[model samples]
Target: MQKFFAVVAFAAAFLTAWTAAPDRAEAAASRIKDLAAIEGVRENQLIGYGLVVGLNGTGDSLNNAPFTKQSLQAMMERMGVNTRGANMRTANVAAVMVTANLPPFATQGTRVDVNVSALGDAKSLQGGTLLVTPLLGADGEAYAIAQGALSVGGFVAKGDAASITRGVPTAARIANGALVEREIAFKLGTMSTVRLALRNPDFTTSRRIAMAINDLLGAPAAEPIAPSTVRLSLPPKFNGNIVDLITDIEQLAVEPDLPAKVVIDEATGIIVMGQDVRVSTVAIAQGNLTVTVTEQPEVSQPNPLSQGETVVVPRTQVTVNDDSKKKLAVVKSTVSLRELVDGLNALGVGPRDLITILQAIKAAGALQAEIEVM
Candidate 1:
């Protein structure tokens, strides 16, 4: 109960401060690195099919997963152990899909983390060990060899009639399990131009970024090419050394311009309003109308020892409560987010009630910000 009130207090305080200071909110600065990313300088996804072994009677059934049996047979044949046409029964191996991300500029001999997930009806992979598997990229070429003991975060314990499982027992991860055997060719310093892609697309923010970069370098080397992209050409001094130029620009701070928006999550009754949210002069009246029904059953019996059958008599009580004492409140025109919040909070309404009130206000065209329901 205390935590709930603390959250309410925090929300009220945040609303108060967010609307009380417009200059500070608008001038909030963030580093360029957090707002944008360099093109062609990102991680690539790698995946492969492999097998997990050493499970104690918790692996995929050979009859159910024919691929696992085929893979096992092929592996045995390579090791001079022919198991073809021979009855081979085993519940200690599982077919799995191995996945990992090849980091940017990853060189040979460097290791990357790999994920192993069961592709069949494997009860658990807690004590399994991934065998020698080749991780492939989108180009259908093997790039890394992944082979390590599985590190499952969850486990499963079962009895005759009860079972308990935590997390995902069929999935596991191996840190630094895959060794890089190939590299994607991309020379950042050799490029004369590069693009900075904004994580959130906005023309105002993109323009601010270009202006900030130009002002810092004292040259018009950066330009806003699109609402979500900024083009940067190498200057004379930074030719063949774009890394230093990017490092210098990334540290420069710029305040991003965002649109005024209010997000409403109906499932969780969460309302988030931007600092720029405004409201026109509007009158809002909020009251609760509660109807409660109570059921009471009484037993009716004979007072004497006469022949009688006991019967149940049903009794119900219904009550209606309409808070007619509450009055309507008026919000002035062009009010800040703090004033709007304060006016709504004064109505003694919860978050769910506030959501309905905000929606009604938006429907009446009194809210100036865009409302997004999620």
Candidate 2:
């Protein structure tokens, strides 16, 4: 109850501040690096199939998981163990898939974190150590070698009729486990033009970026080839030091124009609104209806003079609450996100209730923003 009150208080304070917010759309400037990234500068996904060894009798069963048995046989033969006809039955191994993100320009011998998830019905991977496995790229070529002790941060315990589990025990990670053996060489600075890709594509943002760059360099070197990409050519003055030009371009600050948006996470009852969210004068009515049912069992016995036997009686109680006195409150036109939040809060609306009200306002063509449910 105390926590609930605290949340309500926090929401009230947040709304008060939101309704009194300044006009940030005209003055605030965002760094170029935060808004754009150089094209071809991204991470590559690397995955490999490997087997995790050294389990404490909680690994996959041979009879139930044939793939684990086959993988174990293949691994044993590579280590000079001839078991072509031997019936091997061991519960100390698990087949797993190793995954890692190869950061761009990763050099040889540098280690990357690797994630190992069980591909079979392994009871747990808490104490397992991944065997020396070659991590491959999409082209089926080995790019890195991963091998280390797994760090499964959870455990499993079972008892007679009940069991308690915390986190997932079948997935684990190894810090700095995979050694990089390949590199993707990307040519920058030498190209005639570099593309600046905006993380969020907007025409106004693209035009602003181009104009900002043109003003910064005193020339029209930056052009908006597309809403998301800004084409920048090498100026003759900066050809001798193209790296310096790139450095300067990334440091310029420009005021980015963003569309008004509201994001609501229904599962968590979290509501997020952009600074520009506004709503026209509206009225909202909110209430809740709760229904409850209760079951009660009673025992009845026959009197001393009666011929009735003892029996059990079942009883149930149902109650319903109808909130028909919901009051409709008037909300004035709210221009800023703070005002909108404050107005909604005035109606005594929680996150879930606010979601419904905002949707209704949008349907009525009063909400001047996009509503996204997540």
Candidate 3:
């Protein structure tokens, strides 16, 4: 009877430890918009083909990049000059594709950064100047113009046979190189209602956001349109300007709801477990195998030097070692994160091995949360 009571006490103690809360603070719940959202504002992509000149002999050759020569000829023709049969020798210029992001509501003369990447076989774009390039938007309309000295964060040098290079040779960037010539039209105050789009859609979080906004501004102001969108009616205070209303609403803090999930990074062998992850009763076993190979050299000497050459013989040795498999551990049902970790750790498995084991367990439907490998 005493032994039975002691066993029961031990089991109770173990259960208590397994169910204990973690030391880390619980993540505060936040609105879907607070966690992730589209702020009704975004940047547009701009692209242009341009020439990078003033290179130190590292530019594309004229024979290899005929497009550069053609572009130069065309530009000269546009300036009321004719170069139909011009024989151009290009050794200090390269053809490049320039790209930039035009920010939302960008006004005229607003300067933006531009990225330039070599489109030809140029060794490097270091110390180059980008000529005036007209940047076009998705609508095929010229929206901005970019022209500045490139800030290539790399260097390249070469001799007759060998070359030394650092950083990326084909890409360079210019700070505040592109000036906005046009802006995208968007009227925030004209709409009777506005929609707030959540970056990450979660039903619980969406509902919380609607409730928080409604509680603050009253029920007649905010309503949930869907799990990912919240439609709000403009109140009298914000009737003239909705931009200020949105700015104020976005600053309101609310707890966010997250789905139970386990994210594993295969490249870095990182395992992240969510709080709500659970495990069913299961058995696990782990072991390792190692193979080793060695080479031995044997020398043979000529006997009395009777026109015989000394030879060497090579001998190869290989061995395989398999470690004893660990004892199978039985995980109980409804196992918490701590219990699951402890159970896996008991098998003396490393992170890489645990990843495969967790995958198998998830496939077997023993892990309750979603498993994601990145």
Candidate 4:
């Protein structure tokens, strides 16, 4: 009797652990750098207006695009060419806008890639050379200059009847095309405090990140200010230097906690469920009703000797299918994503049908997860 009681107690303990395994598996460890980013360390956008030349009769029509004509004339005047009143009808030049991003802490003389897009009614920008354009930041200050030959990903070839183009011909990119001239002043080492912004904001994730940092530094250096922000005060040993502190804590690993969410793309019939998604006890029935109609037209001819004309006759056939073999399936309470998916699959419905069933379940208060439809 003693041995039997001991065996029963062990089995109960094993069952309890097996039931709680799904909850423990949901919190997977993620690196701190992947969960959050250092505040103020980001890229800035720059934009400029310029001209793309050397197109083979695919440039914008000067008659329709007045801005292109005016810009060309202005450029000619700058080059000491007199075109103020001249009839300049050029089909090899197109007006374009240049754009690029300035990486954080980028110094002078560093080169960055630039994207060139046609601003006029140009058919294609292939084999075009971008002229010198000054890229300006949000402060209306010139930060970089971009000039290079464009590498268009697509081309347009027409023979009066048909044309085949693969990619966007009006947009192009130039690798290492822009040279950084002015620097955006930022002193990273002189900061007293730094904030880490969470990419996916959650209160639990924020607290976990702070705890991870505190464990690594052996001090109360990191504090969660909001769901999305974790501010860190400079410890005494760091001596006003925040770069080393960031470098040390950004590599620590912590488990990020996220809320249970189910995302559904109705257009594409795609469903994504979180690991913690669960459902209450519910019964689901899925079946499709199909009705088919077919038409067959026939002509009836009279005998050769009879004085009767041919008559046309129409025939129609119809069939209905209700999928009577499918029956209602019941899904008990779920504890994991796999169990939930298995329960839904037991209804034998496709993704499109599953989308409707999920919505219905949510309406019935059986789905314990939030449903997001796209």
Every model's TM-score: 0.92, 0.89, 0.86, 0.89
Error of 3 at 242 (Å): 1.8
TM-score of candidate 1 on Cα atoms, chains taken together: 0.92
Worst 10 residues of 1 by lDDT: 1-10
* Per-model RMSD to reference: 2.4, 2.8, 7.8, 8.9
Cand. 4 Cα-lDDT: 0.89
Prediction 3 global C-alpha lDDT: 0.81
Winner on lDDT between 1 and 4 is: 1
- Candidate scoring better on lDDT of 3 and 4: 4
What CA RMSD would candidate 1 show?
A: 2.4
lDDT of 2 by residue, 260-336 (tens): 99888778677777767888887778888989999898999999989999998999999999876889877778666
What are the runs in model 3 whose C-alpha is more than 4 Å off?
1-27, 30-33, 36-40, 80-82, 306-312
What digit string (tens of lDDT, one per residue) describes model 3 on residues 1-374? 35433533464465566466473224354434456454466799999999988998888887888898788788779989898887777688899999999998798999999999999888999889999999999999989999999998888878899988899988999999999998888776677678777777778777777787887777567776777887777788776677666777786776666677989887766777776888888888777788999999899888895888889999899999898756778989997666777777667666778889999999999988899988
Model 1: CA > 4 A from native: 1-6, 15-27, 301-311
What shift in Å separates residue 33 of candidate 2 from its native position after superposition?
Answer: 1.2
Ranking by lDDT: 1, 4, 2, 3
**lDDT score, candidate 3, position 307:** 82
> Stretches of candidate 4 above 4 Å error?
1-27, 299-315
